[model samples]
Target chain A: MTIEYASIEQFYELIEPGLNSVELAVYAASITTFFALILVLYKRLHHDKLNTLPVNISGFGYAIPGTVLAMAMLATFGPLDNLINEWALSLNIEEPGLILSGTVFAIIFAFVVRFSAIANGTISGGVEQVAHSLDLAPLSLGMGSIKGIFKVHLPLLKSSIFVAWLLVFVEAMKELPAVLILRPFNYDTLSTQIYQLISDEQLEQGALGAISIVVFGLLPIIWLNKNEEKS
Target chain B: MTHLIDIQQLAVKLQNKTILSDVSLSLEAGDILGLVGPSGCGKTTLLNTIAGFIEQSAGKIVIDEKMQIDLTNLVAPEERNVGMIFQDYALFPHLTIRENIGFGLFNLDKATCNSRVTELMSLLKLTELAERYPHQLSGGQQQRVAIARALAPQPKIILLDEPFSNIDARLRNELMIEIRQLLKSLNMTAIFVTHNKDEVFTFADKVAVMSEGRILQFGSPVLVSQQPNSWQVADFLQLGSWIPVKCNGDSAETAIGSLTDVHTENCQTGKTESSIMSLLVKPQHIRIENNENVNVEINHVGITEQGYHYIVSSLNRTDLSFDRLSFYSHDVFQLGQQLAFEIIHHEYLMFDQAPPR
Candidate 1:
């Protein structure tokens, strides 16, 4: 990390050669998995202007056991990888696994399983509240009751989402298994970079990386919660 | 203009339990029929059946005679051109007033749908609310928009579950007047269902008075008031009870003096000695004694918290000594005050045990 060879080109060469499938898979899954999380969240929530990277990594980033979701993603992605390989063979192409594992498919598969559960829970909870407004049947009467909820239900809940996003953001900064198994080799996310430096016992450098990720996570949550509570 | 709806003996049984027992009625074009009853008395079930939201277990509902829809015959609510206004005014919250009205006119051409919505908005005075969603409006405004939305499609028949229940009491009368006028002027066959007797008298051209699960009386407001079929009907209509009177021909010998106007055949004429023959008298017919002819004493008096709204009657006559008569007067009377009057008219007439038609 400190340029032992005293040359930037040598450092770059040393970093680039040691990349393997495990690292490639992890980085690919992490970034694409983050995008997939955004997609699911976008479908469930439309009003929030907050970005998805902080949310995707922080909320369930560490909560999702990387081994289980990673294994599941591999199984799901295996068929698609084979199909891509067959197409590559038909076209006499050199790379097939690149299309399957190194691309967005592997990452999306892992994150979808996580976010779908969250989206389903959130949407259904809001819908259940609308159902009990009256004993009257659901066709229109139940749906009619949700309008008022849609308004006041927002500003009051902004603080909660902000806090949740912040806590999850910090957690994502420290996520281990998911960062280890999902990231692609060539990629260097903040979490993975910290893991690499820490693994080498580069204490000062690893500490710096860790501090940056935590700061990134906590700042938004505090700012949002404070501003919202003020309003 | 024509018969918009006709139901013949609508006997409905739900889960082996009878909900409606042999119900039948019809509405002509431009007629506003009011269906009145207590809660859970099958009024809403009847409306749901007519709207094709429920399949009756028995009987027939013929719309225009060509469509022989009945208890056995099933039809979806959306398929039938019956416009329904719910008690709570079920306006779609997600949609604006224009969209709500437009939703009903999906089958119409674009220009026609737009024009129809505009016309209905003007008709119901909902022009300003066309762009507003239901949550933005007050109860009265939401009700008007609901009416407008139902009217936009111009269904052959409209069903108003409870036209005034959701609106404030001060505005209920005005809304009733406007709704009645709208129904009449548009020549749309409709039904107004309510438990309030006053709303029935004001808003409906025909009324079906129901109790339990059966209609006690079906006729104009005047007939239902003047001549209910049984003692129960008379009582439910608040027309007072008929006391026991011995009659000779048309002249009846009873309490307060000999009565002459009642037909003798209407009373039990020839029965055993122990057979009970009861005479009918309304509270209004019995009066406070001001003259020295009859001795009277006030039992109780005071304006009730409910203002006596006159729905509840003070018990003036007992079964042994005094007779009851039906009366209509807005004036408040004190308890124990001596009131004197003659039986000028009847609140309702009665029939022998054979039961009236």
Candidate 2:
């Protein structure tokens, strides 16, 4: 088949809308929050009596199909919003209609639940690679455990933390099923737009967005290769 | 000698298994105590327990006549004021040598910390490598950095776990001597655990031999070597080979000959039943005899600076065959050749033989 390239002006017009979409903004914001939440949860649960269980529980989303995860989130939040609204009404306050299920919150929630394992696994592996003696070395030198972790472990885990964030960001960008089921009205991400175009038998029009996803996916691979070579 | 650290009946249990028990040890100020034992005899565990890394199940650890710890309360490792040098050095790889030495001094002002780091770097001969990271340095240099870091805080007591085990054999003794001098010059009280008994002779003021989570003997290196309290202590030290003997009151009969001057310090005099005993036979105590038909076969021979040392086993038809007794000879002897020998005049040390299963 002969492929026709879009003119520069037409290309700019086609790609600019996708880049400026509210779905992209939500993706960025949700992923930032998700990364922060992973750090907070990992830090809190790491040394607890539960050990890795809390992190593993959060990682359960990775084992389930994204479609199943989307349905589970919908099932959970759809009624939680109603219960909140019902309580608001009983208290004689204005009803906050579908506050969670009818907005970007549900989509972000699904993304976080599905991709937490990647962040947890990366950080946990990084933490494990550090010698247990290194953990106690600072303690012997008169530094508290919390301070020692910050001084010693966090600096050591810098690359791993960045890698985890990048991986989750890229994964969230390409997620389709969860976004498709959980997105509010009029919201469209790169993957959803590509999906919509393909469904309409106009895959050629969505080629640039699909290629962007591929380009993003190659980043960690190149980074890992560079690190291995450096080492 | 003022005691800097006193451990009273310290016992540790991990996950329902006893790791250390009745480990009572006392160290004077500026003294170096070597914890020598076979593998898995709780040497490292005792060090960790004293360092506050492991919680004790019973007894107390009293330090510098100040801090005290028992089962109910555990002073956090950070708050214990006890320093430790691990086998792997455990230097913060991300930090420079100067920074590592200054890590314990982080709470101090910048100038004071810098001065302390400089002082330690000079003391440990690491001033030239101060800018280098741990991985950039050699093993011995990294261990020096670990020592400098551990000492930066001026801990009341320092614990080292197999500190020199990773060094080259030729360099290990030199490093031990140098570190011993450094510790002595600084008047630092420290305890180091190692499986090498010779390290104790070269590096420690007092040596402890441990087995099955209990300290078998604790005394000066010379004292422990001169008089090992138990069979296990002498065996662990490998001070001498055992010569089986039949004990009859004050006298003992051996394969080499009867020992009329047997020392009964380790045995009871009025035993109703005769017992089989083993005499500690040092290599210097055995002398070559001119007689040819004595049935002593040279099992192995190796050249030493003193002479050719031969390990001869008794081929005598007597029931008391003393096997693998090391004897030093000025002349080389062929392996498996029969020779005559006699015990020189020496203080006899004998112990009851282990009961056969």
Candidate 3:
């Protein structure tokens, strides 16, 4: 079969999965980054051995193979789903089966666990650049701790937060193993679509999807380079 | 009148290490207290303790004789109604000058907040830069914004941690004078930390000299200078050179001359009769005695606004020898030149030599 010039047909076929990929990446990155910032703030304000526990555990996720992490996620949430279903049955209520085990929530949860270390490391490095006194200056001015963080810290961390979101978003877009194993039935993302076409020896048909993942992956790298140059 | 701030037996521990212990100080309304010490002397820790940033392991802090803070009744920093200006100024880089100054005024109505911010901006001569962010302003301008922000809420007492340290040395004195005058005009009670005793002399109504997590002395600058209570305080202040002397009855014999009618402070009663004592010999207390034998050799010479300044070492008296004897005169002296000098008759100030570290 001759490879034809790239056609819009392949691009048209990728629109649905591309949207799905964007949605998953956005949801996972937002939640992951939010929790990362909170963890950083907690560590800064409270000096305890336990402060590093959650970060360490989350960071450990990045070291695990994606397939293993997907299995772990299923193993963890699958039982919780069964427990909830049993409780519902006990109460004679309708069982909400597999609410977390094989849904978008599970995919997002896996992404968060897999990429939290990236967000935490980036945001933590940013927070370290800020003077510790900035944390107390607002408190001295009669602003509560929460408000002080919003007024002083969050603004200062804006670039770090953006970079972290971009990094996780890129990772989520290209992630294949975890998505392949955990994505709900009939729900296809760019990664899954690209993987399927390649498995079927129709790599040309998935060229647009593969290119889309690569382009998404380059965004944060380019943005980071520009920022490094600016700084 | 009740004191604006009364701290009693304040102590702080961080990571199982005691940072401050038995630190007590009181400041009246409108009085500016300067906390001066070498680095790691707990001046900043004391300030942080007062500002409620660091929890005290022991002791109590009373603000305006109304709010009392102790280990049992710890108050959060924001609710303490105290303000602090950090050494780095800690100005919010993202906020404009006006917005930074108005930050703590969130409790006030919009009209009140705007008025307060405007008034502070004018007072600090920052009206022209109100729209500029902290990073866009000069160090002095950023410091002024920090001051304005700390003062906006009208807290009972303000804590300033080396506020002028970031300023250019050439501008530091001028800025200190202006800020002191402004604080005086507002009748604001404040405590500022610095290692420069000169800053205290120029800006503080009261001075506290700290060493090794303890306040060695606290009094008016003149009083502390004239009657330093300990060897550490006198030595840290550079009040004078230490001349090893032996006390016999009412007089003390030194390498230079005998100081009669010695009045010793912090000198052990029985030990002073035989053991060596360090006399605080101010530069002005020494006079040239050309007719007498040369007793000191000039080691260092430098010019000052006062005149030729020389640091002389004892010539031959090893038992009573001393170095760094500061002397000022109109006559120039070469290094290594022997000179005749005698301690002028004055109220004697003596302290026991500090224990060796």
Candidate 4:
């Protein structure tokens, strides 16, 4: 129950040693964010004339619950490291975070999952504004919609980006089940930091993290709500 | 040459409700067709359908004769080369006025786009507001920007759906005058959908009178106003006196009197061979004629501030009939005064009780 951090030489007593470095990287590569990113990419980049997938998949209503998603994340990523290493070899990428895994990758994938509707809504609203003004077809006016996202759309999305940044940041900060099962070795985020601290009888540190999150989270929630009201 | 824009048997069914049905009309070069109807009568629906925003359930929409596409197979709204000003003018709040007008001209060369934007800004007198966002502009300014944006693409047919409703009513008439002039100078073929009678009369070359998803009449504004086909139409256009009548083949007798000038009277009652029929009379055709031998019993006289009195005449036939027969004049008459009135002339149009035979 007592974990030692003072002496770097005594690491073997407190660690799961048999797992090698490559095996550890593979373990971190599979999780909710990885799978969620797949759904998000399909939703965003699909070019079908009739788009019914994004909404259906955003799981605005039909999402598998978080616990089930956690279970799925574990099963999908836990034993699938060999396949990941094999695929990673084909792509010639040494690091897994570039394509999948850990806090940064999980956050990226989680964002696309939890926030695609907002992204699509923002994009569609921009298109609608131009379409209606020019009497253009909302569909036919899809002129470089992909190119536009980087050129004209991103500039126009200042407010959207700021809001989305706060959402993704906070969600990634507070995410538990995904982060709990997906952190790299010796990594301590504020969310997992609080959960681990509390479990180890450090309630004050945990409470401080919880309090900081509440204070920071409340500000963005209010701002997001107000932005929506104005929009 | 074919008309600039043509629509035939266009029906728009949305959310299981028939918003518009079999409404066919066309706009020639330089023609401004005003689609006038009461609220929810499909005027806006028809305009949106023509602009390609709403898909038509049936019928053909031809643009410039060469692009004859049944709206069922319509080119998309953006590619249709049509323009529109919505009821609210729906200006983009984020874009500056200049950018808005320049948006649809994205295909043009940069120089061409700039010149077109400049020309439209001056054309709409929006030069001062060019840097402002839509929310910063006044209703009239926003309206002009909307028009300028729509017009920048030089669309074949401009569709204006209740364009002035968002503007101040006091400014609407003056703005309409400016818009009408601008459209003429540009030789723009437009369909202006509005419910206001005066707006339609003053702005449109032709009018389509509609109610309950049906166009009662469509023609030059004067024709639709002066010679509406039925009582429903007469009521919609605020035309004519709805005189009660009983008629047959030749002569029709209304509350006012009997008339034998039967040209095309379809009486709902009486034998077709008989000379008695019921018909409606135009208000302008019924007048106070003391010397012409037509008797009118006045039940009440309503006076306006301008000293003119509208006489509400009572029918001796119906006893308690409020026939709503009124005449415009400055001479105030007393209530219950039996006045001598007569048929103004042959302009009194009589209709059958129910149409056909």
Q: What is the TM-score of chain B alone in each candidate?
A: 0.85, 0.96, 0.96, 0.87
Clashing pairs in 4: A137-B78, B241-B283, B245-B278, B246-B277, B246-B278, B247-B276, B247-B277, B247-B278, B248-B276, B248-B277
lDDT of 1: 0.62
> Candidate 1's error at A113, in angstroms?
6.0
Candidate 2 achieves a global lDDT of 0.82
Listed per model, the TM-scores of chain A against the true chain A are 0.53, 0.82, 0.93, 0.55
Q: Which interface RMSD values do the candidates have, in the order shown?
A: 7.3, 0.5, 0.7, 4.9
Segments of candidate 3 deviating more than 4 angstroms: A1-9, A219-231, B265-270, B354-357
DockQ of each: 0.06, 0.85, 0.91, 0.19
Better of 2 and 3 by lDDT: 3
Q: Arrange candidates by TM-score, highest first: which order?
A: 3, 2, 4, 1
Looking at model 3, the pairs that clash are none
lDDT of 2 by residue, A46-126 (tens): 454565566667777789888998899889999999999999999999999988998878877777777878877777777
Residue B330 of model 4, lDDT score: 62
Q: After superposition, how far is residue A179 of candidate 4 from its true place, in Å?
A: 2.2
Error of 2 at B346 (Å): 2.6
C-alpha lDDT (0 to 100) for residue A96 of candidate 4: 55
Shift of residue B109 alpha carbon in model 1, Å = 3.6
| Rank by lDDT (best first) | 3, 2, 4, 1
Question: Between candidates 2 and 4, which one is better according to TM-score?
Answer: 2
What clash pairs does model 2 have? none
Q: What is the lDDT of residue B31 in candidate 1?
A: 85
lDDT of 4 by residue, B111-171 (tens): 9999999999988899988888887888888889888988888888888878888889889
